[model samples]
Target: MPLTAQQLQAWSRQEAAAAQQVTTATQASIWLTLWAAFTGWYSRPQVSDLAARSVRILQPARQQTGGLGAAYVREVLAGLDAVREKAPAINLPAARLGADLEQVYSRPAEAYRLTYALTEDTAAATTAAQERLFTLVRDDLTVARRDGEMLQMRASGVTHYRRIVHPELSATGVCGLCLAAADRLYSVAELLPIHDRCKCTVAPDSDTADEAVSIDLDQLYEDAGGTDGAALKRVRYQVNEHGELGPVLGVEGQKFQRQGDAPKGDPIARARRELAALEPVLDSLESRAAAGEDVAGPLAYQRDRVAKLRAITA
Candidate 1:
């Protein structure tokens, strides 16, 4: 069952879409956390406002169609897991099922860094730092989410993957090195995302597609009302109230989510201002600790948060 290149390409596209869903989920959770942190700081400048700092941005969203309060990122991960089971069940390489996927992911950690930095105690309208952080947030999540997808995609087809950077993206030295090395085949482990905001991708070496057998996923597809040798259900990508991806009508009985024309906008500006507002609390905590008071607990916490912010280097 040799699947055509189109089959692999289609699966790749689906995985990419799912990856973007994860990216968007992280972005939204981060944004919401910043909002809450800012509102708390603005309402009452307190050190406790930093509780939103989860070391990993976690905002669990309830599945609108009905389920546990699974966060947006969790949903994507679950959906992807389902997709993985269904996808490779099609005459994909059997070796993939037992693939070692024990690698831990750090997307959430980087996400925390960006979101935590974006939020501070401030009542100001907007600052250059806030704007810069918001602009880069999506790409940051993109790199992280895609790293996970690359691993998943590699499981089905080929162990070796190649790095692909969109030509439109401005290649930094890191990206340049990846692009130059794009033609070389490497193990999936060797090709994890290099750094935050890294926009590179690892693609299956299609030359090995010849070795990929086409498992019959048509039964699974037909059970879901698909036909004509399709592998995945139509209407798999979606957008729900949380501004994260959802399953469209056919799968989730959800109405088609109208895509918003506007880009990620300025409401986030106020969120960043919240981080700026944290300065007062941080300053107080630092001073009390400096003067040698028992403010150790409070000061340690504030320093941890401020250090996360400073990690942004913007």
Candidate 2:
């Protein structure tokens, strides 16, 4: 009962779609957390109380969606069992199941920081930050929900898996880097590389690398016009390792800031740079305040932050 590549592709598409549904469920939970944040739920509480409350609100989402994801993985494995029943049933550890929950839950706080740092207009900044927060939560949860399936695939005697690119499934079509890697076998030990709203799926393979289905690499070159072309070269070599997202597709002149890569400079120097950047914002706020505009709250917050930065730099 050997499975054909087309058969794998079909399964991958269906599973990828189902994964999106799971992601949608995760997003609903995230929206509630975001609403709580915007409504000042986290602002008025003690840190310890906030932590406890956050866990209460987020834990159910984690458990419910995690259970669903694990069940989905088991169902997928059961289907693959018809072809080869070598995989053993195993449960994902509880710690691993909710590993990313804290990070996802902290996004609103991160957005709060970003809202202040980005713009002078509080309303506009808040809107932008909230939008970014939703996107980040959605993307990160997409990966988190699939963690159980990936872990099970590796543990279930799967030697390798194929990356199926479903560009048609997402509005943001698959990038060339993914396209280059698609339809090819990767070791199950490797984490699947993904980007924002990626709809790719990995199909477990019991076969050797040599027996794995192959993809035409030259087709990318053909699509890029020729082998010597810059576009083709970038497609082949611009792949980068992202600390948070695993492998990432890169174009020319692109840079990545990995997790914990921030706060790089000395504290005083960083503070000085921040103060320098905030000068124009402060001026704008001051002019608006003098014009009888009702920007006192934002003005005060900015002035206080500037004072703190100056004290540090001094």
Candidate 3:
């Protein structure tokens, strides 16, 4: 039987958890293959297959990691389904691009990268997939405005491309560039397309536009402020959990609080609370550093936490 919306959500959560486990296992297998290769115990194909399998397993997880935007899509679709159920006589547009929409909403970024990666050796398929994606976005998705290559949508949102191709793909520019553009227009928390060929343009709706803010990456780094730019870079890398990078910021709130002035009132208390939460992690990293052990991963996690804290404080 077809799953209802609630059932689908439940199933999706379960599937997401299971898929995450598989992805982790696959990552372990790849790491093992790397170790085997380093020890001269396996041929190239063995290690390659392990990595490939890991990518395959991680495909769904990576796609779903778009966070709240994916949830929004699911909710919107569910609402549509409810409407259909309540009023059978109500006419609704046939989902001619259902599969394409699913492909987009299910995992826009990874799907684009995966399709590109898989079909690198098959130019025709690559071209076809790209075309298919473009057509769906251009023809099917309700466009609110179009100015040159930039297209804004009423339903799905903004996309910019040199031209449209297929329902499932596009002939747009680099996916990362598209993502960067989307990130500028939408909140980082929002789902942004990450297809290599996606050049979608977007502007926030009237209600959302006031809240929409563009990120200046350089400005952010500048605002972090430190005498040593290299040190700042290292700190960022460490926070991201790069083993090669040394500890940038401690997990403890003490170091962070000392670096920045505390806000007034309850906000200061909240900041301190966050720092308290992070203290143990920071201490662990410090201990590891003193022992000359790699603490990149922990550092990265702490850095991310600190970044979030800073954002909240800001």
Write candidate 3's Cα lDDT for 1-314 as tens digits. Answer: 33243343333334334333443453444335332233111223443443344344434333333222233333333443342211111122232212333333222223333332223223443344344333333222221111111211223343311111111122221222322232333332232232222223233232222222122222323333422334333321101111211112232233322223565459756876776666565666667678998655445555666667767767
Better of 1 and 2 by lDDT: 2
Q: What are the clash counts of all predictions, listed in order?
A: 20, 0, 27
Model 1 compared with the native: what TM-score? Answer: 0.36
Leading candidate by TM-score:
2
For lDDT, the strongest prediction is 2
Error of 3 at 82 (Å): 15
The reply for model 2, stretches above 4 Å from the true place, is: 32-104, 116-118, 206-234, 237-277, 283-300, 308-314
Off by over 4 Å in 1: 1-14, 36-147, 150-158, 168-178, 208-314
In candidate 3, how many Å is residue 270 off? 56
lDDT (C-alpha) at residue 191 in model 2: 65
Sort by TM-score, top down from the best: 2, 1, 3
In the predicted model 2, the residue pairs found to clash are none
Q: Give the poorly placed runs of model 3, Cα more than 4 Å off.
A: 1-42, 66-69, 72-204, 214-223, 226-314
Q: Judged by lDDT against the true structure, how good is candidate 2?
A: 0.56
Please report, in order, the local distance difference test score of every candidate based on alpha carbons. Answer: 0.37, 0.56, 0.33
